[model samples]
Target: MSTLRMAAVSAPFGRDLEEDFARIGALIEQARGDGVGLLVLPEACLGGYLTDLDGAAELPPAFRVGGPEIARLAGLAGDMVVCAGFCETAGAKTYNSAVCVTGDGVLGVHRKVHQPLREDASYAAGDRFTAFDTPVGRIGMQICFDKAFPEAARAQALDGAKIVCSLSAWPTSATNRHPDPAQDRWTRRMDLFDRARALDNQLVWVASNQFGAFGAMRFAASAKVVDPGGEIVAWTEQREGLAVAEFDVDAVVDAARGGMDFLRDRRPDTYPATGGTPYVAA
Candidate 1:
């Protein structure tokens, strides 16, 4: 298999559509120069994330999946496979969504299924987890809080995803704040989730997050690429930059699963079914 160069971005984006596109264009040019074949941008990189998680925070502008914005994004992507987040609207409903694209147009899309804090007040929950084919490999996408759930990544892996891109606008702890954003507990949790999910599913993990501050929220920008063995291959720790890594996706994933084969040794039959009554000690 050919070596694939991928990057996860840690940069700030705001409510200004033109400003956001300018930033994105510059990043794409940078990635192109770095020979990146796959690029994952931060969640809500299109417009911006909520100012506060409180239900009162004004929502970002919503766009259609097939709107001009995505078309412009695809044009910027050209031949490169790019995954980015945006506020998507379908009729009266708005979703925190991610889309994968190239010059050929969209490859796949994922609506955020999990909502943290008061996020539900801003966007509707997604229904399912699915992986799709891309130039790099079979890729799956999940937004911010979705990575915390084991089932989310597990479902993608089960559906043949070799790489999972997690886009986040995750912020610092609301309470017990740390002076340095890097030292914050929420930042640690974000990193932990990336590593844990990669190890659990034995696939390549790429994570992108917002940098700097937006509204009352200060984001934790720890973008990274983790190997199937749960090792950090490349990272941009608490800063604005790109975490770039190059490797043969199939080779690494196969080698990781060769030993234990976590996916092959499942015992789903013994697992409790939905709504199954719990056993009580006598």
Candidate 2:
């Protein structure tokens, strides 16, 4: 039976490797008890996040790309693939990148494509798309704002990803409040990208986010698992606890084979990649 149980972590940004490792330890313990095979956490997890530190001399010096932080989290989980966000230093530039790790070792990494306002000022856009084979099924990762872009997730689907996991540090958006008619409309349009990717592609879209506030930056903590049909399976509105769910790889495979085959109906004839219009742009 092809199955992948996953955990989405949501907490404030931790300071150094020790702090991150401690959280990873707690995450591992929870995952172990839940029998989860995969764990996805928030963005910039290793290095603490603050819009003020764009070029302020890599604070800890220990916070470089593929630094000891990577090994620490990788070693923490015995047999699970963990996706975490951290700063990636290439040449003299720093990128908002996510590290993909498994039981054996790191399975490549992806830099964030579409960064926020301050993010673009700080991070260089990532050029590639990452899709890899996992014991559960083919999986992919795109962080925060990347989920708002269609192509980011669609590209993964095209790459044969049955499950696409998004690790985010989504700041609290005014539109995502108590569901009123107007709020409802706004929410759908906003989350439409996430839903479209899942429903249209017939793939599971796991949106794990860092909820609550890290000083001034706040995450909605609205992390949830959207099924292939675009229906949310399990999630949380507040960023306090952990959300865990067991998914059947067979179901995902079967779903992608049915009605909404986003991959099959691709208009590669006219359109380019899955990335469409900018969500924030009017």
Candidate 3:
């Protein structure tokens, strides 16, 4: 299929695993009804996010990646592709992870690379960035703060990701919470990052974020689907809903990169060779 319908979600998730899965099922069914071939959900969609970054007492228990929860999610995914975030428990360590699944089984997974502030206290970070082939297309997944750094998305782009799904549980600035969370500086940064990342790599971007309040944090839900030209084709600005868009994946990418290939035009050899402090990868 040249043109594929996609849906990106902006919704609140809590510690109630059953409720979360129910909501996910509803969203997936809704997307399927809307003829969506792919659906992207927010980070921590499986379980609620941390109450606050200032060291919360208790966090949602981590789940094994190959456990029943992921299997149920995969079953619900059916034919349509789904990408959602969960706290992944591997051995004794837990990491913030995003998994892509279909009716058949797991497609790919990404452990968040960049942890902001006190996030490290809750979860381990991922060591690398990779793009993998999904039923929809070659895509990459990145969690919240990961989008802030140009390298994260670029790494996926260089690895042949035509589409990047960014799942975030982002919130308004704790110090200066804007009366309108949508207008907050952090929200602006999120928007800028989405567009910049899409434009920089000249690829399609699907950004899904959390909405509403959880503990002391209130999210700025700005889920959106950006075209290869860095324009929002569909968006839910601070609202809890799905932003839907359709595109002939390959055609869109080709048209945006026809004359100028951003990937090919890179001069990585001359870029600041002086290595400073490298980001800690999980």
Candidate 4:
């Protein structure tokens, strides 16, 4: 498929597995009706995110990567390639993970490597970034705070990912509350990161975030689809909606990199091997 119809969702999910599946089913049916081949859902859409970033909040129930929950998700996905976040279990360890699936079964899985605030207290960190083949394209996955780091996305890009899906459960400022969520600093940062990552990697970027309030957290529902040129083609700004767009993925990526290829002109050799010393005035 040359032209891919894709969507990034901004919707709320919670602790109830049944309720979450209901919401997910409805979203998938809606996307199928719209002929979307790739659907990206918010982080923790399976079991919900931490009630609060503080260490005191209870962790969500964890399911194995090959567990029945993922199988159910795959069955629901049918022909559409869907990506959603969930709490994954591996024996004694639990990871905040994202999985890509279809009726055919799982395509890719990413355990979010970066944890924000006190998140580390609840879940163990993932060690690697990987991109895998899917019906839609070569896709890389990242959770909320992972996108804040350029290296995370770059690693995937370098590994031959053509599209990146960023699933987020990001919330607005916990302390400095903003009357309008659209103007919140955290919301602004999320949007900036989405665009910057797309432009920096010259790949299609689909960002999905949680909407509404869950416990003490108020989410920033700025889900969007950004082109390789760093332009937001579709956005659900501060609302619960699906940001959808159709484009020729290869064509746009080629166009973006044609004039001045960011990846082609690399200076990795000049950069420090490890964290370089802080620059001092000469």
TM-score each candidate: 0.96, 0.84, 0.95, 0.96
Error of 2 at 69 (Å): 1.5
Instruction: Assess candidate 2 and give its lDDT.
Output: 0.69
lDDT by residue (136-217, candidate 1, tens digit) is 8899999999999988998888888889999999999989989999899999999999999999989999999999999989
lDDT of each: 0.93, 0.69, 0.90, 0.92
Instruction: Kindly report which residue pairs in candidate 1 clash with one another.
Output: none
Q: Residue by residue across 60-164, what tens digits does model 3's lDDT show?
A: 867877889999999999999999999999988889999999989899999998988888898888998889998889999999999999988888887888899
Alpha-carbon lDDT of model 1: 0.93
User: What C-alpha lDDT does candidate 4 achieve relative to the native structure?
Assistant: 0.92
State residue 97's C-alpha deviation in candidate 3, in Å.
0.6
Q: Which tens-of-lDDT digit does each residue in 1-282 have in candidate 4?
A: 379999999999999999999999999999999999999999999999999988888989899989999999999999999999999999889899999999999998999899898999989999988789998878899999999998888888877788999999999999787899999999999999999999998999999999999999999999999999999999999999899999999888888888777777766758756322232111
RMSD (CA, Å), candidate 1 to true, equals: 4.7
What lDDT score is found at residue 68 in candidate 3? 92
- For candidate 4, the 10 contiguous residues with the lowest summed lDDT are 273-282
- Tell me which of candidates 1 and 2 scores higher on lDDT: 1
Residue 87's C-alpha lDDT in candidate 1? 96
Q: Clash totals for all models, in order?
A: 0, 2, 3, 0
Clashing pairs in 4: none
> Candidate 1: where is the Cα deviation over 4 Å?
274-282
* Cα lDDT for residue 101, candidate 4: 96
